[model samples]
Target: MSNESSPLQSSLLVSERMAFKLHRQGMIMETIGKNNAVCNEYPSPILPKERWRYQMVNMYPDSGQCHPFGRR
Candidate 1:
């Protein structure tokens, strides 16, 4: 009898544990822009204005909300 789990099983277990930990910590997931991109790196909540400026500049360029035009 093998006592080892398959790679997929291990990964699933890890993911489940991570989700449980996040839920227990009251860490809710959220998106920063219209693109619905996930952001979980920051432990603290960032201001919506700051996030909008950052995401807009990083994700969009032709919109003119960044660089020399917007200077944000």
Candidate 2:
């Protein structure tokens, strides 16, 4: 594996750092879910706001929905 960050990876890391700094300064940031149009353009295995998927799954175990955005 090459120990180098791709342009996209670098951008993500920079954004994550900036978000962390903002969070420490008491600025709240909301993650827009993967279903958003922008995310589709960049399609990745990792979903944006992935934590919400886990929370939803836990809350609706019997919902019978396999997707984070609910049934198609």
Top candidate on lDDT is: 2
C-alpha local distance difference test of each model: 0.41, 0.42
Cand. 1 TM to true fold: 0.35
Tally clashing residue pairs in candidate 2.
0
Stretches off by above 4 angstroms in model 1 are 1-4, 29-72
TM-scores, all candidates, are: 0.35, 0.35
Give the least accurate 10-residue stretch of model 2, judged by summed lDDT: 47-56
For residues 1-72, what per-residue lDDT tens digits would candidate 2 score against the true structure?
Answer: 144357534544555555455546655544456667543232233433434331133443566543332211
- Stretches of candidate 2 off by over 4 Å are 1-3, 29-72
Model 2 whole-model lDDT (C-alpha atoms): 0.42
RMSD per model, one decimal: 16.1, 15.3
